[model samples]
Target: MEKERNITSMIAAGLLALAAVVGAPERALAADGAALLAANCLSCHSAQGGSISRVEGQRKTPEGWQMTITRMQEQHGAKVSAEDKRRLIKYLADTRGLAPAETAGWRYLLEHDNNRVETIDGRYRDMCARCHSGARFALQRRSEDEWKLLMHTHIGLNPTLEFHSLARDRQWFPLAVNEVAPALARDFALDARAWKAWQAAPRTALDGSWRIAGFLPGKGAFEGRMRASAAGEDRYELAIEGRYADGALLSGRGVATVYTGYEWRGSVDIDGVALRQVMAADARGERMHGRQHFADSRRMGGALSALREGAAPMVMAVMPAQLRRGETAELTVVGSGLAGAVSLGKGVRVLEVVSRSPDRVVVRARAEGRDGLNDVAVGSARGKGLLAVYGRVARVEVEPANAIARVGGPGDAQMQKVGVAYRAIGWAAGRDGKAGTADDLRLGYLPARWSIEAADEEAEKAHDADFVGHIGADGVFVPGDAGPNPARPKSLGNTGRVNVVATVEAAGATVEGRGKLDVAVPDFVQRALD
Candidate 1:
C-alpha cells in the first residue's frame, strides 16, 4: 500500500484516469473490509451495533474517512496499521461513500481551492463555517441524530463552542441542537437517491491508455498519455509521459485508486517531483477531470482533463488559449480521437498543418479582425472557446487578485518558503467598447512589467518592498528568509503587506493592473484536507 500523506490538491492535480477494472471487486465488498474495521474500530464503535453502527449511518468521501480514522487515533486512542487503514478506507468509500452528485457545489473543498471566498448561506456560515471550513462539513452526510451526535462531540471536545463570538450572543446550544441539526440533516441527509444510483451503476474500469490535457495556471498547457495497469486488488500503477506547451517533457510514475466508482486519487512523481492527482472520472470512466498539485506546496498546481485512448472524439485544450487579431501564431490543438481538417472558427484561418496526430495537431493560424472566443474543432469534436482571439487590449487584469506568500523559515522544518506567481491578463473591450465592464473579452496572459508597492504608509515605514520579497523578471515574488532582521526596527522577520502591480504595453500605451499580496508566516498545522 502507498503511504497516505496529508494531501489535498488544487482543482488540477494532474490527470490520472483509466478503464476502471471494476465488477463488484472483492476489495469493495463491505464484508471483509468490515472485518478490518471491526478489528480497529469495534473496540469503541462497539457501543452501537458492536461493529459498525455509527459508521453505517453516515457516508463520506475517502478523505473524510481518512480524517475520521486519524481523529479516532488522535482523540480515542484507536490503533490500526497503515495498510489496514488504507483497505478500510477504500472499503467504506466504495460501499457507503457520498455519491458524486451529492458532492457537487463543494468540489472546490476537495480540490483545495484555498483562495476561494465561499458564499455559504448565513445560517451555515455563522454556525458552522465560522469555526472551520464550510466545505469540511458540506462533504459529509448524516442523519439528524448523527448531526446531533457530531454537535455533542464538538461541544464535548471544545466546551467553549457555544461561547465563541458567533455563538455567545444567542442561545447557541439550543439553536444548534434544534434548528441547525435538523436543517443539516434535511439538506445533507444520509439517504439519497443519487447514492443508490451510484452503487447500482457499473463502476469505471480504469486500466489501459489515457490521453491528458492538463493546464497549470501560471505554467501553461501540458499534453500527455498515461498507461495504467493493475497493481493490486483495487489499485493501479500508472506511467505518465507528455510535454508542456513549450515541448518540455512531462513524465511520471504513480498509482491511483477509484473510490465510490468515480473518485480518482493518486500520486505521480513527475520529473522526480511528487504530485497528487485528484480527479472525478465520469460514470463510464471514459473521461476524467480534476487538478494536479505540487505535493508539499498545497497552494501551487494546475488543472487536468483527460480522455481514455480510443474513446470518443474530444478536444482537450487549444494551446495559446488566446490570440490577437490580424496576427498569425503557431497553435497546438491537443485532444484525442481527432480526425480530418482542423478549424479555428470563423475569424481564424488555419494557414498550415505543421504536424498532426490523434492527440496533438500543430497549426499556423491567422486571426481575422473579428474578436471573441473561438471553438477549436477537430472534425466532429469541438472544444468550446478553447481559443480566444481579440482585436486590441482594452484592459489588463491580475489573476488571483488577493494572495498570501509564506515567509521562508530558512532551515526550519515547519516553516517553508512560499512563492507567489503573478500573471497579467489582457482583455479586449466587448461590443460596448469599454473596459472594466462585464463584457470584456479575455485575451489570455500578457507579458507584464511586474512591480510592488507598499499598500499604505505603515507598510512603507517598515521598508516592506525591500524586506518582504523581490518580484523577479518572471513576475514571481520570492520572499526573504524568516524573521529577526537585526538591522530593522524591533528585529522583525521578513513580513509585509503590499500591492502587486503589473503593467501591460497595449496599443502604444501601458495599462496597469494590481493585486494584493501578504508576505506572512507559515501555516503550522497541516491537515489532509484543507
Candidate 2:
C-alpha cells in the first residue's frame, strides 16, 4: 500500500508539472494544498533524493514547518502569498513532518551562529551593511580627529554606551577608517585639482548694474558697479555699491583667496557686519556651493550662481560735462587742478583758461556778466595764452502754470486759485531799466474766484520800495486789483500789461526798468472746464 501511495504521489507531481506548462496550475490544483506543494516544490527537491527529501516523507510539528517556510521566504525571494504559507505549513505538518536528521543539522547550524546579527534590506545591505549598519556612524564622513571628537560627544549624550573604554573604541575606529578612507581620498584628490585650476585663472571683472538674487535674510535686488582685481595668484579684491531693493544705499568690499578645484576663501562685509565664507563649484558649472560663517559663529551652507549675464557696469563713476545755464565754454581744462577751476565758475560766472597738466591761469578777458541777450562770451584771459574754446547755452522754460496750484493751494476743491507760467527770454534792457521778462506766459484759474481783500500793506512795505509785485509763475509782476471776485468762471481773458522787472549795471551805466510782455491774463479769471 505504501509503495502504491509513493507511485501515486510521483504521478500526481508529474501531472502537476505538465499542468503548469500546458494550462493553469492553480486552476487544476484548485485549493488542493498537497497538489499545490507538490507542483511548487518537486522541481527543486525530489521526494526521495533531494536536499529536502530526507524531511519530505517525515512528519513535523507545525512550529518546525512554520520556521522552515519563513526561512525560505526571507532568503530565497519566494513568492508564496500569506494564504499559501498557512496551507503549506499545515500540509507539511500533517503529511511529511521534519526528519530527526534534518532537525539535528538545522539546530546545530543555528546554535553555532546565534549572535543575533541584524540583517538589513537589500538596498541598505548593498550600501553600508558590511562594515557598520548603524546609520549614526555610517552616514558621516569626517576626519579621524573629527571622528574621535564626535564619538566623545556621543558618549556624553548617551552615557550608557561606555565611551570611556578607549581600547574598544580605538579598535573599531581603525577598522572604519580602513574601510572608508580610500573612497574619501579619491574624492578629495579630484576636488583639489579643480580648486587649483580656479586659483590660477584671472579674476573676471563685473561691470554694470546686476540684480543680485537668492540672497538670505530677505530676498533683495540692487543696482551697483563691481570691479575685481587679482592681488597675485590666489588673492582677489571685489567691490560693489548701489541702492538696495528696499531703497537703502549699500556698499560692499571683500577679499578672497582661491584654491585648487573651485574652492574659494573670502570675507565680505554687509552694512559693517563681516561674514566669512568658503565657496566651491559642483561637477556641473550651473551651481556653486557656499559655506558661510555668520557673525554669531553660526554656519550655513547653500548654493549660488549668476542669475543673468551683463549684470553691472565695470567702471566706477563717469562725470559728463552738462551745461546748466549759460553757454558751455569751449576751453578744455586739463590737470588735477581743473576741478578747482571749474568750482570758481559757479553762480552765473565763467572763467576761460588754457589747459595745463597741474594748474590753470586766466589767459584773456575775465567773464563779467551776460549781455543784452542774456548770452555770455568765450574769450582768452587778460595776460595768459589762448586755449581752445566751445560754448553752448541752456534753455530754461517754466513748467505748466497749474502745477503751481497743486503745490501751494488749499486742500478744498472749492477754493479759488490762480497762477502764471513763464520762461526766461534772456537778459534785456529798455526805458524802465534792465529787467528780466516772461518770454512766454500763460495764466490758469481755479474752480472758484479766490477771496479778495486789500493787499497786505505791511508785507508790501517790507520789500524794496521800487518793487511792489506778487510772485507769479512767471517773474514777479505789478498790477492793480480788479474790483470784487468774479463769479465761478472757466476761462481766462487777456490783460494788456507787462509783468517782469530787472536791475542791471554795465560800464558804469546803471539801468532799472520793467520787461516787455509777450502774453498776459487779467487779474480775475474763472477756472477752465476739465
Candidate 3:
C-alpha cells in the first residue's frame, strides 16, 4: 500500500509540474468562429470560385478535425491561437461532424485502445495500415475527388511509400488512386442520409443526473453518479461521486464540452488523479459509452458507460458483472429508474434485497448451475451484455494477451518504467463443454494469483524473469531498474520477453491464463496524441 501511494504521488507530482510550466492562459476569450476560419485557412487553401479548397463537403470527429488543424499548424505554417483553434474545431465538428452511426467501428482510434490491430483487406491494408491505424482512415467523410486527392497527398508527403515491401509488389500509386481511393469514397462519403437524419433530430439535453459504471485499470470495477449542469453554450460542469465494488471511494469534479450533440469530452480530477473521458452520448442523451483514462497516459484506461437519471427504467450496468455457481455474493445494479424486484440472471437467485432506489439496487444473490451469458434485471428493465453467470471457472484469460513493457533509460533520472496493469477474466466452456472453442464464453473479471515465467521454449534458458520486472498482487507489472545491472552477464540491460501468468482456482483446480510481456527500452520522444 505504501508503494502504491508513492507511485501515485510521483505521477501526480509530475503532472502538477507539467501543468505549472505549460503557461497557458487561465481562460480563453470567446472566439469569433467565422473570422478565425476565413483568416487562417483561406490563404493557402484558396477560396477561389467561392469555395475554399478541401474544406467543403468534409466532416470529421473533433479529434479528427483537431489533428487536421494541428497538421496545418505544424507543416503548413498556419497560425491560430489555442483558444481560437478550439473554437474552430468546435465550429467545424458541430457543422460537419460525423453522425453517430458513421463513427461506430472506428471509435478505438479516438478512445486510444492500445491493443487494437487493423484487419483491413489486403489491398487497403497494403496502402494505408502500413503507415498508421486503419481507424484513422475510417473516421472521416469526404467526396470521391477529395479521396483521390488524398491518395496523391499521401504519395506527395511520403515519396518512398511505394518502395515499401507491401507496396513494391504492385503499382502502388495507381492502385491507391484507382482502387483504394474510390472504395473509401464509397464507404465513407461525406453526403449520407444518416448524417442528415441526425441533423434533423432533437439534441440530447445535458443538465441532469447520470449513473456511471466503469472499471478503473489497477483499481477494479466502480459504480458512480455524475451531475451535469449546463455551464455555458455547449459546455457543462460535472460533479462526480461513486465507489469501487470493494468500497473504495471514487469522487471527482470536472467540466465537459459536448460536440456534435453527442461527443462528450470531459476532464475529471478524482482524489488528485486526473482522468479524461472520451465518450459519446446517445442521440437521446440517455446513455453514454466509451473509455476514460489517465490524462497523461492513454493506454492506461478503461471502458465506461452511463445512463441519465430520468430516462425510462433501463438497466445500464451491474457491478461484479459475473456470478459464480453455488456461491453467494453482493451485487449492485446501477441504472435509471431502477426499482422493483431484482432478477440476478440465470443460475442466480436473489436471496435478499439489501437496498433499492430509482437508480441503484443492492442484492445478495445465490448463483448455481452451468455457465451462461446471464441477463440481469430490475423488474421490467433487463440488462444486456452486462452480466454473466458461470459454474466453476473453466479458463482464465488475461487481456492484451501480448503486451510490451518499457524500462526507463539510463538518462531517465526518475526511472519512469512503463508499467502494464493486467486483470484476469474467468471463462467457461460453451454448450459443447469444450475449452478454447469458438462458443466459449467470458465470465468477466475475476480474482487470481499472478506470476511470471519464461515466455516459451527458447526463453526457458534466459534470465528474463530474474532481471526484467516484477508484478504485484494487484496485477500491475513494474519494470526493473534502469541502466546495466552489474550482476547480470556482461552487465546487460533488463530487456527480454517473459510470460505473465494468472492462476485462478476453481473447484479445487487451478486454471492459468498466460500473456507475453516484452520488456524493452523506453521511448524518449513523446506527444499528447501518442
TM-score of 3: 0.87
The weakest ten consecutive residues by lDDT in model 1 span 10-19
lDDT of 3 by residue, 55-99 (tens): 885789999889899989888888888987888888788778999
**Which residue runs does candidate 2 get wrong by more than 4 Å?**
1-174, 181-211, 218-225, 281-293, 300-304, 307-530
Q: At residue 50, what lDDT does model 2 achieve?
A: 19
Candidate 2 local lDDT, 10-74, one digit each (tens): 65765655566555533343335556565445554556641234343233334445655675666
What are the runs in model 1 whose C-alpha is more than 4 Å off? 1-24, 47-51, 217-219, 473-475, 527-530
**Which of 2 and 3 is the better model by TM-score?**
3
lDDT per residue (tens digit) for residues 1-530 in model 1: 11111011110121111112235446335555655665566455533323256887799999899989888877778888888889888988988799889988787667765656688878899999997788889899998999999988889989988878989999888888899999999889899889888888876678889988776644556889999898766688999999987788878899999887788898889888878888898888898888887787756666787788877787878877887777889998988878888999988889999999877889999988688888889997778887888877888887768888888678876678878666788888988888889988887777889999998899999989888988876677778898688867999888899999999876577789999888987665562223
Backbone clashes (count) for model 1: 18
Error of 2 at 441 (Å): 61
lDDT of 1 at 172: 87
Cα error, candidate 1, residue 433 (Å): 1.2
Task: At residue 96, give the lDDT of candidate 3.
Answer: 84
What clash count does candidate 3 reach?
0
* Better candidate number, 1 or 3, judged by lDDT: 3
